[model samples]
Target chain A: MPAGPTERPTIGVALKWVDLRPEVDPLTGAIHDDLHSFGCSEADRAALEWALRLAESWPGGDVDGERAEPPDVVVVTAGPAEADALVRDALAAGATRGVLVDVAPDAPSPEVAALLTGVLEGADLVCCGDYSVDRGSGSVPAFLAAGLGAVQALGLVHLEREPSGTLRVTRRLDHGRREVLAVQAPAVLSFEGASAELRRAGLAAVLSARDIAIDVVPAIAGRVARTQVTRRAPYRPRSRSLRPPAADLDVRGRVLSLTGALVERTPPRTIRADAAEAANLVIDQLRTWGYLE
Target chain B: MTEPRTPDFDVIVVGSGPAGASAALVLARAGKRVCLLERGPFPGSKNMYGGVVYGRILDTLIPRWWEEAPIQRWVTRRGTVIMTEQQSLTIDYRTTAWGEAPYNGATTFRPDFDSWLAGHATDAGAVLVTSTTATGLLRDGAGRVTGVRTDRPDGDLSASLVIACDGVNSFLAKEAGLYPHAVPENFTLGAKEVLALPRDEIDKRFGLTGHEGADFEIVGCTRGIAGGGFVYTNLDSIAVGVVLSVTQLATAKVRPEELIADLKRHPMVAPWVEGADLKEYSAHLIPEAGYDMMPTLAADGMLIAGDAAAMCLAAGIWLEGVNFAIGSGKAAGEAALEALVTGDVTAEGLAGYRSRLDDSFVLADHKRLRRVPELLMSERMQTQYPQLMCNLVEGMFTVTNPTPKKGVVALGWQELRRAKVKIRHLLRDLWTSVRTFG
Candidate 1:
């Protein structure tokens, strides 16, 4: 069926920023915690690029990890705070505008697709990674085409506007099958991972953007907040209901049996001391074992 | 009714710990604005104590608390053991006066006891906010203590008076300047471990019938440090711990965990707890330096109660302070009530708190027993004396082979003379103890 033309459309990207991880000085080994934690995500990363104008992150209450907060364009990548940072930088640099939202922990397929479809807003150009390292779920753009509304193009490498005022996009699919699509404006486009078209903001920008507060308005939902109940009582570990034939077994066998048979639910062990003591002991042990510098 | 999550009231007591929940009970019954704060997952969350309860002060507040409190057992027996280089000759007193209802002394897990007191305060209409901590104090202009600020967002609330009822090393008190300096060296730092055993085994081991418990007070097990050990019997567990001076500990270069571990490893101290699983372990500071470390009791708009006021006495014979804490809390509460009624919330208005304390057993005994900690820290008691007394007891009591020794003959007059301990010194120390403790 001579694969459908890849949709190349411009969508808004609102990049919200998160602070960089704190690092220690290598020479003196002194901890440097002075870096201010501004919830600023910049545009520019190792793996991905940001496109489209900024939009608000959906404050929608989460059902799974996916909140209904719409992303203007589904920018998928191997999860990196750097990628999120580039998206924010793109917004500040006036390249695109869209709120950067954390893909929820263990986000489900339907929710991610729905979130993308909502962002698609009928845009055909959706750019995204073919696959990712952290969460291999790369279905946001294609699934948005399937679920929300879009004609998705797989493995989009480049997205640009033509002199004739139409959008163009290129994709690779089906064992060296390369294709291009000329689509209209307002299309959903996802970029491939490692396509760093977005640039990192320099110090002057980071310091300025820090004062600009990004509001985190949680989307209110009535869904059950906690899916599991963990009751720690007397904080003492109890015997698991599943006993190994009430006898001896290898650790792997015990783990396998516990996972499979579900016979004895192993109770959580109680910690008799405070977190500091336990943490200090583990750190000390690691140092003693020559594991920690 | 799930307690219907009662209105956090004028006072929501967070902890049933002495200073905290005690304020709630005293003021609630008196009909004042108060709240008790506790961060224990429950009433006794993170609560543990050695079981030498001083009751005379407590009886005035709870009135027959020994009758109703969840005490493991009344202490009809007390065992004091002085160690030799190898063995210990012990002295025990089993007075029937202790076995009666309204026990003179009882062993308690602070969680249960503190919770019960919190409940009493609640019954008097103070709401208790469990699993909550007063992270900060709510203060106003001129540096007056107005209320407590908690860890929760928008957790700020106001009161006319904020009593620093928290506890030893109270963050709130220190922040409020109730205690500006670090707790001193004579302060007792106690670390306790609870070992669970079968109730039957516990009863047999402690030589108790059903519902009876024994407390063993120990000296010298602190490994030449200036502190002592205690073993209190519980329902199905044993509370064994050591209370020592932090300064002396630092001077001896003794790590507390090692000190406690060594204490548990002692031959005489181990059998009762041996093989029993350790359930809970915690450490707390007890105000023990006595007399000199007291902070100003009343501030512009606040009062210091419990350990905040440094009310503990580490006297050798009778070591106590919880009830004094409660009493001081009650006195503070009453003074607060009067201040609130009179619409006077200034430092001068709170002056009554100091006088109220002076009138009560809290300051009275603290002032009276000022010499106890001194006597306990005396150089003579730390050396020579305990050994001499233990040697005298052994000589008077021990027998060898077929020949039995008469008490006076076994005492060995020749050796006594050679020991260089004159009768005058004995007379002098007795006079000293009488003047100090009596």
Candidate 2:
């Protein structure tokens, strides 16, 4: 970690152009055209919001109730020309500057990671969404962490700066559990969907954002692909069994039949067993219902 | 005279509807630096219309526009349908000529059509700035309109000439003192629903094939309301709606949506739109004041066209506004070019815009059928006349074994008597219709 209370961290946010095409048409089962129109992903927006909140809340940045000198926030995205709008949206949402890396749409994850590592040279903290909405691969953050040789925290639900100038993060574990960890500066954080809500871009900010020039850098060459897919398949629907309606019966007859089917007439037997025996019985019943390991 | 300095742009046209886009296309093609401002996220995103485009104004702008643009269908059949509670009378006219090239009119969904026109304007070298609304007019030291102030930061834009193509309720025109705000009587509220159906089903039901379409003007379906109803066919959908006089609708107890619902459930209308799924419901305010409500067309460094100038003709038998807007917009562009060449953008310099409108059918048609609004809004035209017409048709068609079949004239006389209409009243309305419609 760097010296505490002496230096403010520079945060870099990774953004991506998320496709917004409807998955399927319910009425016709026909897929819609996947147009080139794209927008900033929701998870990326959350990460950007997290960075902004951290920078704004830094201590001693303001003097005598004047406007605070917030930490520098930079947004970076690597995609084709269509990603320019997404980068501009980050600028509108209060990012200090934006850097766009022009890369082919089908560039491998390692190439993207390498480009991001170059642009984020001096960034003390790097943040990105845990998974992209389009691919859902959840691998970019890991690749970036490996390339930068930085401490990586994936699926972070909460993040804040500690009093000692170290970074504190809370990772969301399965089954509604959370794990808190403290790490030094120059770390990479991938935020889950539970991160901070983003602030809206006002008209003034949007107009000013239009004037900001985005730095476009070309992609690097001589990158070997680590993975390739040879086959693709859409999600197959599971079969469902539906019981036939009792159309032959009248309303009263159907009601009686439904009541008889739903109600159990057997009486319950009282148990005079010990606590251990009762627990074993309950465990066995739960196992039969597939509710236990 | 002071020398004229070049502004940021040669011309700035506000609102990218038919008028603004048309003006931008012409000015940009003429090699003038043009900037088109639209408040919506895209051109025509905020626009809605009654689904008809008449005349060949678009053809002159974009030769054989239908081949490239997204036209719903060419209107080959048209009719006027008069309805009573249980009966209807129709006067229909169909022509094969209308379904071919150089067509008379076509149907369009405004969102697609307007955006395509704006695209052409951009292709001709116009800068289209969407989501930027002109908040107010910018004036120079001499009190002449010079530019516009938008809602964005540092969004002030200057131009040599400003064309206000804003729709019916034009805040810019009102701000410039060229015209007062329109009263309720000068406007109508139109509620429309676009119901989707299969292309083949729509063609089969409407008796159309290929790219042909139909337009039906309906009366007596409005429950005695002052305005009228309409049903227009598109390729795979139908636009069914009612236009009610704003003043009359305000006094009546029925809501506009309720009126449209009743029209959909009407015996004569329900069969035509059966089994169709509703796709969109929209309502818009139409300028119906005609020639009497037209505002001043030009001023110092400013020109107004389309609904902003009250250029819509809502006269019975001729409901048109888009063609008028296109025509007026073209004239504004040409007149502005003339004024620019002379280096005088004053009110006097732009006076040729008025002459151009006079030369075109926009002003002439409005001037000719200006009284149709009054006639259509009459109580008898809304209720008694349609009822009598439908009753006369039903009476002539109904036959009994014991009773003799009645002639058309005899059935008309008996229906007129039953509807409590005097012969003199009928003759006066007939004479008025002939004079106005002719």
Candidate 3:
């Protein structure tokens, strides 16, 4: 639904706090907080890009048009003081204003959503990354939508502005499927990292935004309790549970059996046949490799 | 023409390395709105130097900096080694005082140290703008530098004063024609590799304990190139590298890494760095011509500091740079502040920068030791002298079994004649050294 001429819609973009390059202690394998270089993550930047696009195409939203009335883009993030730089960068990238919910670095996603919920009131739509690069739980958007009682469209891979001014969003689904939905204002949309590329801010915008004061509000209490990390380990993918080769077989035989080499082996063949038969043989080989049904 | 534009910042300090950071810190502390621009992602991301940093200049800027600074190790042992392919004669000195409070010199990764110093400037109220390259100087119609133009769109920032501390290969200083004598011969390329070892392993191999470190300055290890090699200890690693003359290196077609490899594989050096894993490899250009190649320190509305001003001291016995950089940066900052207060941001007004540097150790040391760089890079110092000294030491230690022992003078003459060094050349170097360093 399009906003009335007098009413300017507001799009809220959720930026995540993450270190672009984190220094790790060689001895302890721990992150050195003082050495962290922070920047906007791809997923969060894509969400902001989606929000900007929404604002650009909205009714009376053309920047160069005579009656320019682009929707307000409010960027919000919840983290410690260092996160203020992230908000400043978003403002430089064309955010109308920025709000930093001052929260602990270890604050849970639900708590961060609760903190953002208070500051992002009356925003017509909220856009968020599918997940952050650091603490990638990706549950804040759902919690925010619940808090605002807004329609939630998660896992958005594509978004377009319809002529009628409603937002048409395509969501990624399991098994390479997509679900297209017509999203109205007052909806929470979460976007994937590849959805859009964020525009670079000129130095003029950066210089101007450097002095604009970002609203830093304290984090409200969350209903969910914080969880402690008692143990840290590198992520290990689950290994395939392969059947053991016959114990009596030789080592080479066992290796070949485990690799399915014996079953896949094909001897070189030479055939004097028509071109059509050779083409059929090539197609059959490709089919055997599962390249075709 | 239009009216002169109001300045965006009181001063624009280009490059946030030690010099720019120091200058910004001083000006910001004086209540000047300073903008510090860095081309790298962070303060020292693009910076690399030979292992140890002599940080005595930080005493005034950061009280008890040793307590909080990101120091890898305190150099408790200092050694100067003369080497041949298979032999080394080391002059090793160890003092516990260097490992204690108010330490002498330390080993640090530049990225950590540079950022830590830049953090102070920002904390003192300077706006640090990283990843912004100042492409050119913004000059007024009257040919006075007003500010800088960056690589970004609408990146023109105006300021009353501009301090170029933009490291070696500083395009800003070159654009301003401050470096009339800049040439490839005036610079040296230093390539370093950091090898990681376990803490206990490093302690055992390098004979270090409790955050103590060792630094070795090796002569005759540059494969006859007019430069030297350095091997210093970090907390859990060792930094081994070589500095080679840029012209000699290019002429010989020898890579800098091969020199590092040769140094690491040297019989004496191999024991210390054996089995260590290569953690990182970095290379940087050092401005080594000393006083002769130093750029004009000040111009209209501008002052050059740090490596951009060629303040590195590459004298043989005292190879130091970071301290000189910090020293010059502090002077530049103070001079800029005075100029701003006096409302004379002209070439003559900023002349105080030169006087301050001359009075301080930055210029005084460079001036006193100006002849040392050329002397050290001479063929006699690079090759013949090292061989003569090594053979002399070898001859002294190996006593004759059947024949009578030769006198020390006879042995010295024998080694000198065998190394093909003339007596007159050695005496000339001796007199030059005594006059310059006496």
Candidate 4:
């Protein structure tokens, strides 16, 4: 892809324009279709900030200690024409170029990935927000990584670039655990939405961005994924099968026995218990509450 | 000598309210590279106003602007009310002419109206950059304003001319030593609440039909706080508020909302605002001294318009600001154009702005009614006159069975004595009024 290491690289950033939040009418309880609330998603903004940081740090390729050209931070998105505001915002925030891929508003993640993969061919690195603010499916990065055959590091909470040209990132896992990884060039990394904030655009940049013509490319036919829902209902907890109490008793006694009202609750009491005894006590309470056999 | 730095824009208009938006609109339409800056997410997100927009100033700018401007309603009825705690007198007038096209005044939310006007500017090729505050003016070594320094990093924008329309608390004007009388005595605080009501309910309550509205200006309602009150109808809401003198309000130790509540509960105002739900509450500083507190209109490479220039016409019976802002802003834009053509953007070259305003209704109206704000806020006018007027009206209307009804002149003299208004003071005030409004 041009001369490697010596030539200027392109850092691609995937952007999504979405409404920050839905506002409900306080009096009527109806959602207002307010267009003013729509703008670039927070996650996408953070990813743009990360991409800009990378480009600034490696202004000239730092590889092999040779002075080379800096990378170009380009922001790309696939959406309707109104999404141009997102590109303009990114450019105002210091992105070198903007590309708006014209596509259907509801295009699936796989289709978007395929379209973006074709356009970002020469990019040495592609950065994206882990999930969009609206749908938040978080599948586009995975799909794009698969399409490009590039190393994928998704859901990164922390990121830094090493002097040796590799990117070190920390991905948050379940139960407060973290997974750290080092990724090389030709990689796709998706950062958590709250990881970083985008810098404010300068007035000169904001004004000049109005004149920068965004590259709008028509979408090519690609494999589109279809989704269907057969049935829909609000979620509810499953009911537990309870053992019934004998009916022959006083009204209060029968009610209390069936509800386990008196048997389950106890006033504040504490005791210095050994670890084994404490374990036994917890298990006994669990069994009494029918949580275990 | 070093070559002069090239300007990034021909004109930089700060604060995209009526004045800035109008200036940018005019400059852009004349094929000038203009930039309009706003400190909100959108042009009008941070703006609020009293109630109505008297848009005759916009006639030449956007011909028949009412058809598509996001107007809530056209005010068809106007009422001037005088009140004393329990007694009230109203002088109400209604006209159908205002309901028709090319109408007089309208009620609209500031956010929608300002954004709509800014949209016109942008549509006409003016670059509107929002969410950026112009922190200060950028001046050359010779003390000529060259541009503005914004809050954003590396946000210094250079321009040939700077038009300061940055509202009443304009720091730019203060920094330029333009506002000589900038003090609490020269400003008023306007606090308002937009109360939601059903559209049909509003129409029924206000005696209006089909995009018609009503506005009521009330006095003797601010509890002698040297201010007044207003209630106006929107399409689906009513804006009710008070304008209090900042200096008096400070020592009064009464929150503005308390005064608004008192007005709402008054016998005259209670019926109109019954069962209304507050949709929004806002407060803003108003430059109310009319022509007296107006700043120096033009400075080196800079011109002031709108509230920044104290262009608001706060005279009694004709409470307006937006129209004056638009008028002054248009004049500023025209003056800038002329200066650019002559290649002299200095204060002397921009002196046409002042003359143009003087020739137009903006300065003429302000100059004519320069003493109105002081006269209106005087102790006698704020407290005693309304009481005397209401008592005199009551004396005229009330039928006395055994006691013969007093003549109108005699009853007025009796009420004047009861209201403690000395004859000499009344005569002096009458003379002042004649000389002022003559």
* Cα lDDT of model 3 by residue, B291-362, tens digit: 999888888989999999998999987999899989999999999999999999999999999999989899
Model 2 global lDDT (CA atoms, 0 to 1): 0.83
CA displacement after TM-score superposition, residue B294 of candidate 3 (Å) = 1.2
Interface RMSD, prediction 2? 5.2
- Candidate 2 lDDT, tens digit per residue, A141-190? 88887777788998998998887767889999989999999977778898
Candidate 3: which stretches are off by over 4 Å? A1-5, A23-34, A61-69, A104-118, A135-158, A169-181, A192-197, A220-222, A225-229, A233-293, B1-5, B399-404
Q: Write candidate 2's Cα lDDT for B235-258 as tens digits.
A: 988999999988788888789889
Q: Please, what are the lDDT tens digits per residue for candidate 4 over residues A169-236? A: 89999999999999987889998878999999877688789889899989886456557555655445
lDDT of 1 at B228: 79
Compared with the true structure, what per-residue lDDT tens digits does model 3 show for residues A1-293? Answer: 33455567788999988776666765566775642567657888999999988788776744344465678899998888888888988988889999988888668778888877787777889999988877678898999988877889988988898886678999999999999999876888999999889887777788778899999897666456778788986556699988999999999989987888758557889888799999999899899999988
What local lDDT score does residue B371 receive in model 1, on the 0 to 100 scale? Answer: 73
Worst 10 residues of 4 chain A by lDDT: A26-35
lDDT minimum window of 10 residues, candidate 3 chain B: B1-10
C-alpha root-mean-square deviation, each candidate: 17.7, 6.0, 5.9, 5.6
Candidates in order, TM-scores: namely: 0.58, 0.80, 0.86, 0.85
Best by the DockQ measure: 4
- For candidate 4, give the docking quality class from DockQ: medium
DockQ of 1: 0.02
TM-score of predicted model 4?
Answer: 0.85
